[model samples]
Target: MPWSAMRRVIDVSGDGGNNSGPPVEQARGRSVAERIVINGLAIAKDHPPFAYAGPVPLEDYYREAVIGGPGAFVVPAEDFNQFASAVRRKMIREMAGLPSRPRMALAD
Candidate 1:
């Protein structure tokens, strides 16, 4: 939260739906308006715990709905097991502020 910080990013990680709070698009828009970058990490199906794919194409939804600003992106985790690695990749990209390809695949 430092004023001198070069980049401001708010990472939003979750499964495919937004069942609470403001809609994903609305939040992404607001954050972009505030000069903050928004990135998403979509968790795939809970095969181990629940055994079902996500209700939607999370990576696609995230790209269109949850991420914004210059070089913003969404990373897809194949499942909960891939969450940590996907997050790590996302953090590296965001912190570096590098201009990456329009789409990035964060796989296991």
Candidate 2:
């Protein structure tokens, strides 16, 4: 099927890096150019042996790894306790077509 007439999104969530799928950069490029928003949710802490697998700074990782498109958003859950609420808020914002606030960076 042609992509222009369809909406395609690649939602990527993992405890670790892209060790088992297609390269993320390529995926981001295509999705963004095609106007498909790639929203991300990263769990900062998981249970048991899998706990350490998640990124230390999940929001940072999402910014660097998963989100794409004009208004892409990457919302992080500090731990499993906040996962559901975070995911709900992210989805609601995305679905409602809300715009993100400007981001600031510190100068050295």
Whole-model lDDT values for every prediction: 0.79, 0.73
lDDT of each residue in 1-108, candidate 2, tens digit only: 554534455666654556667988788888788788798887776566666454446677678878987667777777878878987988787667754568999899
How close is every model to the real structure, measured as TM-score?
A: 0.75, 0.67
Q: Which stretches of candidate 2 lie over 4 Å from their true place?
A: 1-9, 46-48, 52-56, 98-108
lDDT of 1 at 50: 52
In model 2, state the lDDT of residue 17: 59
Give the alpha carbon lDDT tens digit for every residue of 1-108 in model 1: 456856688888987577679777887788899899888888767555654354557788788788899888888898888888998998887767754458877898
Clashes of 1: 0
**Number of clashing pairs per prediction, in order:** 0, 0
Clashes of 2: 0
CA deviation > 4 Å runs, candidate 1:
1-3, 46-56, 98-108
Candidate with best lDDT: 1
